[model samples]
Target chain A: MKRNLRIMVIDDENIVGKRLKPALEKEGDIVETFTDARNALERFSEQQFDIVVSDIRMDDIDGLEVLEQVLARSEKTKVIIITGYATVEVAQEALVKGAFDFIAKPFKPNDLRTIIEKAAKELGR
Target chain B: MNITSGEAPIQTDDPQFSHHGLGEEYVEDIALKSRPIISIRFRLFLAFLVIFAFSMIVALWSIYALSEIQVKIRFLEAAGNYLTEIQQARRFEKNFLLYGTNLEDSLEHLRTAESILQKNKDTIEKILGRNSIQGMSLQLNNYHKVLEKVGEAGDTEERNRYEPELREYGGQLVSDATNFVVKEREAVEDALSLSRRVPFYFLGILMVLIIVITSFLVKNILSTLNRFLEYTNRIGEGDFSPILPKRKYRDEFSQLGLAFNHMIRELDKRHKILIESHKLRAVGTLVAGVAHELNNPLNNTMLTAGLLEEDFERLPDEEKLDMVQDIIKETERSKVIVRNLLDFARASDYKIIAMDLENLLEGSIRLVHNRVKLAKIELQMKLTPDLPPVHGDEQALQQVFINLILNAVDALPPRGKITVTDSKSSQAGFIEIKVSDNGPGIPEHILPRIFDPFFTTKVKEKGTGLGLSVSQGFVRRLGGNITVESRVGGGTTFTVLLPTTEVPSSVSAAPSP
Candidate 1:
């Protein structure tokens, strides 16, 4: 049997991280949630994750910076960007900047689950 | 996805708006209409006619006086010739009496004097009266008879008797003639001198009249001009009071006042429309942020409820209650976001009240929070605590700060910095707030025109260029001012100085007597 996936979620909206924790855990994965992107990034620096999900906009730092730092640490880890009022330009820029995929806000857990599944298959796990 | 419309609609409040120029409009209209028309041209004509009529009277009087003097001169000349003739007869009488010359010569001279008197008798009568002329004629007749008797005398004794009578008559008649001529000459001289002085007095009176008329006309025109100047300044300050007639008679200036009132009404109407459109534009900009902000809570509620539904059968009752509570909290958050925006978007009359600047700034910060986030710009606030309250309209001042923030956001690149700081101003009785941005500064050449209406550096579709202009207008109306400083490479800062409200100045703040 394959090892369980290590996943991380970062959103300023605390509920986004709270709800996602249990939902991803149900799918036989280890999920760590953070309301602060800086804290999540600090934790990422100490540990390794198979995937990192972050909101595009936040108070202190943005998701794109988080994406850049994560990719710099380990290029193999996949990054999924979450955006509110997502425009075409932002989505295209996220893809060009090496984000695995971009998702608009108010998406169901299953929708994120599908994108994660595709990333997981690419990892061959 | 469609907005959650199932919940009871939240918009129950009225849209606050009013026609600013419509107050007391009918009263002003009636005041302008209740006047008679009299053009300035007619007034000038009337003034000229008065002067013309006065000059004609003076001219006629002067002509009559001169003609009378001419008649007196002619009479004096005739009377002088009659006097000369009488003196010649007297001299010839002496030659006849002393040198024993022929008495015919004296008689001839006396007869000539009599003929001269006869020729000028009617004129002399008109001048000296008919009674005086008859007296002079009687003396002349007696002198002539005495001279003729001497010519007819047969011996020396008869001639000697006539000689004494001739001498008495001759001396008396000549004296009377000389006295009449001298008196008439003096009278003619007095008339001539009077006629010369009459023209000088008329000129002096004419000068005084011209001065009076000129000052009357000039004062009317110039004072009206000065008043119109004041009206233009009033309009510039956004006062749209119509001009009313101030004079008894309506003249060209009254028509001009009416024209000014018409222009004021039109300008006021246009200004109201511009303000309305500017508000709508501001509302549009705010709505986008509101819509984006609304999604967060909606998403939270959706996720919480959706998961709760899917796990309803498996989840514990405590967990279900927690999910329901989360859903409630998120819905409530959405309501607050919408309400704040709605309050700003609604129009209201100018209501100046003592307001807390710090609290107002916080509200404005919240309105532009999402825009600031989306642009990836860092916004900081350093408000002075317990600052003196300022008199201002809440909605208007809110719009002003939002415009400043949005403009800064537009100018800044991602990761740029914006700091909003407030402090006591250098000028007393004012508080200064500065919105500074670390964006590529505006070029110096176009900086002066940034607040001009319809002057824009932004693209045509993206901007109507009224944001700064309208913001400045609002601030100025509140007894405040907005200023800007920028460099080519250095960042830009907009400083707003607002007047602090003094205690007990407001009508409501004052204690009743």
Candidate 2:
């Protein structure tokens, strides 16, 4: 029997986490979600997550900073950035700063599920 | 040089030519049309020609009149000389007749008088011609013969007879000479009168010529300048009506008029561009405000829709599943509209690259193919093979094409057609792509407002109204232009012109992903 994967979702909007948490949990992964990024980062240091999905824009501690801090804390954690204000520069910036992948908002949950599945496979490897 | 009242003054709407500017500062109160046609160069030339010709005529006439007077004076002197000789001969003849004892002195006087008479006869012949002098010459010869007879007479009676003949001859000679002098004086008077009249005739002809030439020159120069001034005034007032076409003679004024018209055309173009850019700026600000307000709500809807889908297993019924699907679908639609608004409002950090236009068009068509199929709309693509690449952001350009295609799909009824064609533009270094539809066309009244933000004819659920405006913005950012033409019952065509780029060797021939 394989051990369940650990995934964290961070967004300023409450609905984003509320929605993504159950979706990832349904795939037999342990999912932790947060609306406030600072609290998510505090929790992230206490426990290791195999994947971190974060919204780029937030009230405090944007996704890129979260991505850097998470990578600095643990090199193996896959950070996926999501943005409503998606542009080529923002995506490229996120990817260059060690985000595992970048996706625009208003995308399907299945799209995130696929990226998470690939991230999980990489974690197992 | 009087200007007629028939000509109208130039009118213009330009602020520079307003009453406070050109009217008050530059132009005088005199009606421009009523003002005399004044070309300084032509006027000066005419004045110079008239003055020079008049001076020449005056100089010539003075020389001619003075010479005539001199000839007349010479003739009078010649007549006086001949008359004096005739008086001297008469006195000598009378002395010879009265005093026979002083015959030697009388003969001497007679000989001197004969010599003077002979000299005067030649002069009179030269002056009056041979016929008038013939009688005088014969008279003088007869008087000389009579004198000889007096000198040779044996008695006083013979001498007295000869003296009477001599006196008769002398009297006839004096009368003929006096008659000749009087005729010469009359001829001189006639000649002097003719000389005086000649100058007036020449002056009359010259004056007529001067008037004709000056009038012609003044009118020609004045009318041309008047037209130029009128054109300038109209241009200053922002009226862009073309100037009069150039005349056959390509003079300085003609060249100036051509250059002036060219300048006006350029100014008009710049003014139009300035106005359009200002409109764009205003729209940009409005779109930014609206987009920011709409984005969060749209995001929330999308997330909530996702949450519904995530809890789909626990929702308990198929009806709920259908409703969740509807929410997701509707939310996706709203997200597209919000994205379009954001795209229009946001200042894109444009990444320009050499992109194959044919590939871009094909990819865009493929993106909307499913919708086109569902609508039963026929898609026709006629891309020019080996079409040149254009410099633009692929995603932005794709958005423009996708928006156009979707609009075409929306406009069409079942079995309608959408045709997209691309070709090299007739203008150098540019390519033209046309997206056309055979659906019911856009109305004429709303055609001008098609590119305006939030302007749409579609129902609230069907459109966000930002599509065409955002497409136009994207094209403009890529240094291209998009325009549309539609007739009421006829179909609509949207043409986009984009600048071509030189593809670098490193770039692959494959279409952009």
Candidate 3:
């Protein structure tokens, strides 16, 4: 029996979190969305997520820091970094820092969901 | 706004008048560039001062030297007169002794000699300072007294006795007179030789002084002039670095240099403003293009989102997801366009690094490949193997090539061919990248203005008309140039000439075993 996947979405834009919450929830995953990176990082520490999708540019804690923190807490957790201002250098840095994948902004929600589904399979769900 | 009757006072608010003002300013700018800031008068003054001083020194020296020679000649003439008087007295004494002529002729000759001797006494005194020639003067008086005694003798015995005495006296007198003449002759010769030698010595000294002074003046003028030349050369090459005059002396050259430095500062300020205004204009044009470009993707996304919403219940989950993906993809497309616009408008600091042309060309081709493919364009790349690295900013140069390629793609018809060729330029130390396309060629009249900003042949939506202009700007900053050649029906070729970095031959030749 496959259990529900745990996903965390962090973006500074309120619409991004609002849109992704319902979209990911429709896929039968327990998705938690945060518009503030600090609040999201607090939520991340309180609970383990199967897949952590984060925006790379944010006030306080960025996606790379979130990735490092998540990986430090749970090595199996997949951290995916998204950015509006993505360059080859930023993408490579995010991946080198233990991100499961790096995707530029305005990406399809399905693109993220596909990565989350892969993370779920890795979790043996 | 309402139009009044024709009889109403004629409105004087013509836009052409404002444009005329702008034309005047532009003409003024041209005049400023053409006219020399340093006045010719200042330079001429410097040159005239040097020449005038040189001529003045030469004139004064010659005058003094000539006058010295004249004074020596006068002295020589006085000595010659004294020598002539001595010769005349001796000749008469010889006539009286040898021919035994009448006493009257003898006495007359004696009297004439006495007066001539007295007349020349002052000249002798002038030569020998009155005391040095007293012995010569006393000898003349003794010869005169002897000749007078010979004339007064009464009988033959008296005459005979006095004659022998007179012969002895005459002999002594002649010998003394000969010595006086020789001494005077030597003095005159000494004066003549000295007068001759002094002028040459003075002239040699004067020449040396003149040469030293003239060279000093010339060196000062030349060094200042050279500095001005170097400064102007730098300005000509578009370097606006301030010139610090080598000397702070308040000379005309220094003042001119100061004025030049001030002008350069002004020019640099004006140049900065011109660049800023140009950037603003480019940004304005880019904003228009960006807004238009963004409209299409935004509209597509909005329509797709609305459809997804309406069909949410009836459509299959896969179809719903596809629609959502379409919206996301459209959004992303708009984002990419905006990013490119911002990158084009952003004023980035220039960085020059050695870059391989092969990789740059491939990257640029890849960027435009999808559009090129969709347009059914045939793309041919003939990049020479191991083309030398050029020094430039990679991203900027990449933008340049991508812009050129896209422009070529835009100009092409269906199934057109774009040939990108790279080779070492015939101009040494440079490499050439040529992008040639076979399409409906640019019009002959329009070709010259192709690289001008905001000048476009395409419909407004197709281009912002900044691509070629921006590319030219980038190429120029990289110490290169972009030029286009087109014939009305014969397609267009854009040639980019870039300076190559001097890579060591050994590095390119072979690797060590």
Give me the candidate number with maximum DockQ.
1
- Regions of model 1 farther than 4 Å from truth: A1-3, A42-48, A72-76, B1-26, B29-39, B84-138, B141-156, B182-216, B244-249, B347-361, B375-394, B400-513
Q: Residue B386's C-alpha lDDT in candidate 1?
A: 73
Estimated TM-score for each candidate: 0.76, 0.43, 0.47
User: What lDDT score is found at residue A53 in candidate 2?
Assistant: 92
Question: Which digits, one per residue and each the tens of the lDDT, describe model 3 over residues B35-59?
Answer: 3444445545665676578667766
**Best of the two (1, 3) by DockQ:** 1
TM-score between model 2 and native: 0.43
lDDT of 1 by residue, B1-513 (tens): 010101111223321243333323344546555667666898799889989999999999988988988988887887787888788777777787777684676677667778888988888888789998999999999888878778777777878888768888888898899889998999899998998798899899999999999999899889989988998876664555567667666777766776676677666556556656666776787898898888888878877877887688999999999999999999989998988887777656667788778878888899898889878889999999877878877777877898899889999988999999999998999999999998899998999889776678888876777678777877876778999999977999999999989884562321111
lDDT (tens digit, per residue) of candidate 2 on A2-86: 3488889998767577667766777888999999999999999899998899988665577889999999999999999987667
lDDT of each: 0.81, 0.70, 0.67
Poorly placed runs, candidate 3 (over 4 Å): A1-125, B1-135, B144-156, B167-265, B351-391, B402-432, B439-491, B497-513
DockQ of candidate 2 against the true complex:
0.11
Off by over 4 Å in 2: A1-125, B1-43, B101-127, B163-168, B191-213, B237-246, B250-252, B282-286, B289-306, B316-513
Ordered list by DockQ, greatest first: 1, 2, 3
Interface RMSD of 1: 1.6
Top candidate by TM-score? 1
